[model samples]
Target: MSSDALAELSAQLPGDALLVGADAVEAYRRDRALDPTAGVPLAVALPRTTAEVQAVVRWAAAHGIPIVPRGAGTGLSGGASAVDGGIVLSTERMRDLRIDRTTRTATVQPGLLNAELKAAAAAEGLWYPPDPASYEICSIGGNIATNAGGLCCVKYGVTVDYVLGLEVVLADGRALRLGGPLIKDVAGLSLTKLFVGSEGTLGVITEITLRLLPAAPAPRIVAAWFASIEAAAAAIAEISTTIRPSLLEYMDRTCIDAVEDLLGRGLDRDAAALVLGGSDDLDPDGRDVAFMIDAFRRHGACEVAETGRAEGEALAAARRAAIPAVERRGRLLLSDVGVPLPRLGDLIAGVDAISRDREVTIAMLAHAGDGNTHPLVVFDPTDAVAAERAELAYGEIMSLAISLGGTISGEHGVGRMKRPWLREQIGDDALEIAERIKLALDPDGILNPGAIFEAR
Candidate 1:
């Protein structure tokens, strides 16, 4: 049956579109989260156009086979983990884009990388502000799938905010267009946003129309190093509540040391935590920078510095590289838990307690202004007991976030890794309504069967 289905799909797609065999399908199995339970797919379908995507969906629907929609496979939440006997639908080949200056929007195919989109917009003297840490490699389609937030999200907003429209291929091969460049369309049920963070459960995004802004001045940065984690956290809480920073981020001692070891950039390894704050406001008085410095001093920051353009950019880049640098220490169980700005300090303290209790190395970092943190739980894969403890700590961190009136996932979507805790975060009534919507759209549960919602 698998062989026959592969043949049918091959016949319908372009000659090089359908790939079978273990060697060809291996790379499509797992995303960045590297879910160990990810299954070997029956085939991978690389579609270059919307019609081809629709055709692949139709074929999978007819066979009642699951379809895992993947875009660049850079997702950190295992949202694109392949399923057994399913078809991996990759949109990496569908790279098309057009920037309309008049409309202040860019219409693009789902496969286009976020960096590529930004460059295109920059060439036209426009800017697309939603930039994830992996913006250089992560696809725009995946950003929409997770409603991804980033460094600039502290002020500029996330992926969903910039999305003006989308062309999605539904489970039954029907193409649906929602919203457009006009910006003020309230004629419908706001269905476009419904699919933004759906994690591919409802449909496959074929194309997107993103809102753009006129390019703004680069931000000036303030860097602070503290002798205590609580001090740094207190400063972040103060800055977040008091001012709107273009960027605000935090890194614990483990993260700072890891990054310093990797880059040799003279970072203070003895510091308990490092905080970076930025302001792009046109004010010449540099009020935000002064305010941040004062807050840091008041919170007992050991050392503080206001940097110029080159130095500031370098600092921001180091913050972005925190994840990969820390990963060099050991295998990681990444967590994306977030809370209200006022509770940021408590969340940090709770995570620290969990790490100590579990005896696991959790290198913490965050978009501090928005209270979204990425705690990299490091464990030696060779040590079974250590791995188990790390897993426990991972879930505990999410639970801690929930206890603080936060979410299990801030931007990475509820993917398989976080699915177990989704119910606890959202409650039964909300989950049921979400499940009903999933069934109403993809009755067979073919589109990303085990991503946001479980396969029935």
Candidate 2:
């Protein structure tokens, strides 16, 4: 990472495409994870097109500098954390999108924000379903990178479900278009699927072809409050067994108080847990809603009621705001661990026990119908002991999920922070195969080094 080399690399692209200077480079050091171990980079590259991205990759290949491809910096898994003396390739300037009404597909550059895509699709009476909590801020590229899942994913499916194609620039700077707008194409290996959640390890995705659905009916919502966490978990498990909810979310009391404190949203802070169920089926009998209400009461709900669209959307918005609200208390070690649907209660209960054992305040929330939960361990940064405990609690939650035959991450990719535990979950044989595949595609080991796997 010599200045001479950076100058040469900078000269390869347009003057405005490269970012240098201490402050500019520093700003790109961490994503939303705020990974403490993130390093300073040599320079940042803001490529506006696939050709510009190829120029950067070619220059990096010539110089052997690690390249960390970054989206909107909204990632939670430290997947975009900068590498020391490496190149930070920012796709923020690559925002180009086109919607094909006849094909019902969106061909977009990596930098388009998820909300922008949704709005663009909505204008044409279409819908793009994978709405992660950070959809408003997260880029479509980031969503594809992590295979991001959202509230309505229980019904519509995750990011991978919508990605129909991709144009990726490989490690050797060869741009390959993997798939197309065709609904079903098994012509070759599932290369498009490989890149969807690859987290920039295999290649840099410049464009995406996403499948879109016709607009759905406006959802009706239900809010259920429980006297005990167990009761809420029971209700979620029961409802999941019977009905496929458009949205099923869970928030523990700690999260409730945090959201209330932040937004003054009048959340029921006294309740042990709050569960929300949403449906868009347009069934005149409202069968799903009725079933959910019955399950809540049977599982000992303190109060259960169906609310109007306004209040329901507001509550859902609050659920989406949980992370930022809880962050106001202290720095958070966020854990996205999920278990089998039937073991959802066990996972939640285990997280609680870990928090108590480690003496940390753990605020919990989930896309409950899918059994994926975010258990946030909060601690003051200045308190070294507390931070250590928070880290321990975070690991414990992931390990507990593993013990229950679950994944360490349901949507957030296993970035550097979760890499150590990845082998434990996938086992040595599977990890070895993944490493072989990684080496096969990225023989130079330059693409997003030390991400899903260690730097070669």
Report per-prediction Cα RMSD to one decimal.
Answer: 0.8, 0.8
lDDT of 2 by residue, 89-206 (tens): 9999889999999999999999999999999999999999999999999999999999999999999999999999999999889899988899999997898998988999999999
Model 2 TM-score is 0.99
Clashes of each: 0, 0
What C-alpha lDDT, on a 0 to 100 scale, does residue 177 get in candidate 2?
A: 96
lDDT of model number 2 = 0.93
Candidates in order have lDDT scores of 0.93, 0.93
lDDT tens per residue, model 1, 293-398: 9999999999999988888888888998999899899999988899999999999999999999999999999998999999889999999999999999999998
Return the TM-score for each candidate structure: 0.99, 0.99
Any runs in candidate 2 off by more than 4 Å, and if so which? Answer: none
